[model samples]
Target: MIYLDNNATTRIDDAVLDAMLPFLKEEYGNASSLQHKLGRTAHQAIEKSRSSIANYFGASSKEIYFTSGATESINMVLRGIFERYQSIGKHIITTKSEHKAVLTTLEILTKKGAEITYLPLDNQGNINLSDLENSIRPETILVCLMQANNETGVIHPLAKIAEIISSKDVLLFSDTTQAIGKYAFDYAKSGIDICCFSAHKLHGPKGIGGLYIKRKTRPIQIEPLITGGKQENSLRGGTYNTPSIVGMGKAFELISLKYQEQTAELRNYFENRILQEIEDTAVHASHADRLCNTTNILFKHVKSAELMPKLINIAVSSGSACVSGDRDPSHVLTAMGIAAEDALCSLRFSLSKFITKEELDVAIEDIKSAVQKIRKDSPIWQLYKSGVL
Candidate 1:
């Protein structure tokens, strides 16, 4: 099958799987058990993996904390802050197009008396800096933004936002899940206080991820979300999934320049072919800086539910996996001012590092064929052709 849903989850790299094998078998030991030799070995391996992953984002090993995935990491940051600092302030700022992980957490925070201000996005899927700056108030404790959008793959101007919020007293947090493996991220330079990512987005195991908490000079104060053991320096409590952590290290280490060069070429070629072959098709965030491995297309007269089932050989998504199964239109598209009908017609195609021209060619053909068949009885297409739309 032609897999183009890397944003949802990538196929595990063979090398990463190979590195994880030993830990899943004879080397399996609890990282917290320091008394035994086997347990000590596991603890050392986890620390080594943590350091390796830290180097990629220009962070130290002490600032990284492991989690089940981005969802858990994000929850810990948002809810933890609200629980710990409600007396200081209960205000948080975020973008309208954030993944449900951020949006939903903020929703729960509101119930706990946290005031939220959701900044609006422009047509290009970028948050207006002016709107963001104007939204900040004395009560604002955190500004939660994403490094890049999941549905459109649009990269936000996080550095500029950092600079804007730097002079202020509020902390800046970003959900960097989509940007971690696809683009270069410098945590120190970006001025992000805390950020989250998932390993599965980068060809690592699905059940592992990390959080980068910036400590330029002093550590940021955050309360424990799951209070139990002293794992992750008492910031997070749980037994480490040693094999997944080892595999995550290998995956991050393997993201080289060659993969970026190859995947960018495939993504551009596929997008070019789709626009050329299909009439009335448009790509979201076409004028903005987007991830080279992602392309979100709006099949103007077709419904994604109808189109997807027809293109059985190709795997893509209408939106994030968190909400893809629902009949509701993608929140990301709708936030960019897309009509509900058109939003339902959008499809996100995220490419992996190993995609080739041959796979793309077959995919292009299948996509075109699927759209043609799906639109055969579509009243929207009929009305458009009749000039009554």
Candidate 2:
């Protein structure tokens, strides 16, 4: 199958697999056990991986905390800060376009008496900087936003938002799951207090991800999410997955070396081809800056749920992978003022390092043919033909 669903997950890179093979086989000692030679080998590998990941974000290795994936990282940061700072103030701010990881977590926190203000998104799925500024109050202690939207691919005004939140008592947090490998990030330069990312999104194993908690940003005290083992500086607890961690580092190294640039070119080619060939199609977040590898499209008369299955060779989605199961229209689209009908018809296409120009052309052809067939059978097409919907 042609995989245009990189945002959902990516195939593990061969280099990453090669890096992981030893730990998964011959070097199977627990990283936490330091008494034996095998254990020491595992322990050293974990530290090197940690250091590599930390270096990518310009952070110290000690500040990097690993978790099962981006979802856990999100929960850990929100809970860790909330549990410690709820007494100082009970307010949090976030955008309506965040992935379910942040959106759902915030919902749970809201039920526990935390006041939440969901920042509004513009027509292009970008948070309104003015609306964000107006939403902050004395009670607000944290502001959470995603760097690039999982559905629309709109890159948020993180630096501008950081400017607003930085001067306030609030701490700025960004869910960078879709951004980390797609773009460059420097925790020290972005004014971001906390950022979360997943290795699977970067062609690594699915079980590893990390959170970057900036040093010296003390708006909220952080407590452990899991107690025992003292892993991840006591923020997360468990025996470390040495092989996956090593694989993640290799994936990052690959991205830094070459795939990132090539992927950007492929994405651009795909977007250009789509616009040039498809009629009555609109790209979501067109007015906003976006990650180079993602594109969200709305076919005028077809539903993604109905369209995706028709194009079995090309993988895509209606929204974020975490909430794709829901029948409800995407909250991100709704927040951006898109009509429910249009939102339901939307599809997210994320290209990858593995996708070539030729592959994208083939995928686009498959998408176009599928959309044409679906539209021919759609009632909306009949209404539009009669000049009505």
Candidate 3:
């Protein structure tokens, strides 16, 4: 299938897999067991991987903490911080368009007596900086915003946001899962206090990801979410998944801007073709600065549920894969002022560095034809054409 669901997950790169093979078989040893040669080798590999990942984001190795994935990292950081600093301030701020990982975790925090302020988005899937600045109070201890949205790929001005909250006592945390490989971020220069990302989104194995807790002069403090063994400096406690960690390290090393630029060109061509060739089509967040490899489109009169099934050769999604099973329309789209009916008609097409121009061309034709077929059978289309609605 021509996969356009890279935002959900990407295929593991061949080199990353090769780097992981030895760790999976012969080099299998707990990273915490350092007395034996096998254990020492595993420990060294884990540290090397950690250093590589940390350097990519302009951070030190000591600042990086590995977790199962972004979801786990999100829960760890959010809950840890809430529990540790609740006495100082129990209030946090985040946007309405965050992934279910953040939203659901925050929901649990609310029951624990933590107050949450959800910032609203405009029609173009952007938050007003003024609203964000005005919302921060002395009681607010943290601001959780994502660098890039998973559905529409709309980018937030994170550096600007960081500057706004730099003087405040509150810390800035971002879910950088979607933006890590595709966009540029420097933990030191960006002024972000904490962030988390998954390796699967960057062509690495699925079970590995990391959290970056900046080591400042005062240092950010948080309690451990898991406590049994001291694996990640007592911040995260568990036996390391050595193979996946190695693969993630290799994935970080392989990230190239050249490949990302090529993918962006292909994505732009796909969106331009779809909008030019299809009737009554609109691109979500087209006016906003968004990730180069993503385009969320709304095919008026054609429901995505019906349209997606018709294009069996293409792998796209109605919204975030985490909540794709839910029957409700996309929360991201609806929060941006799109009606639920229109949200249901929207589809997100995310490309990866591996996708070629030839594949994108084929997918675009298939999408156009499928949309036409769906619209032809749609009663809404007929009514609009006949001016009867």
Cα TM-score per model? 0.98, 0.96, 0.98
What does candidate 1's lDDT look like per residue over 2-50, in tens digits?
9999899999999999999999898888989989987998898898889
Residues 227-305, candidate 2: write the lDDT tens digits.
8877776678888989999998887777763666887788777777778787788888887888878888888878878
Q: Give the range where candidate 1 is weakest over 10 consecutive residues by summed lDDT.
A: 216-225
The 0-to-1 C-alpha lDDT of every candidate, in the order given, reads: 0.89, 0.84, 0.91
- Tens digit per residue, CA lDDT, model 3, 305-332: 8888889899999999999988899999
Candidate 3 or 2, higher lDDT:
3
Please state the error at residue 375 of candidate 2 in Å.
Answer: 2.3
Cα TM-score of candidate 3: 0.98
Cα deviation of 341 in candidate 3 (Å)?
A: 0.7
Model 3, runs deviating above 4 Å: none
Q: Pick the candidate with the highest lDDT.
A: 3
State the local distance difference test value for candidate 1.
0.89
Note the clash tally of each candidate: 0, 0, 0
Worst 10 residues of 3 by lDDT: 179-188
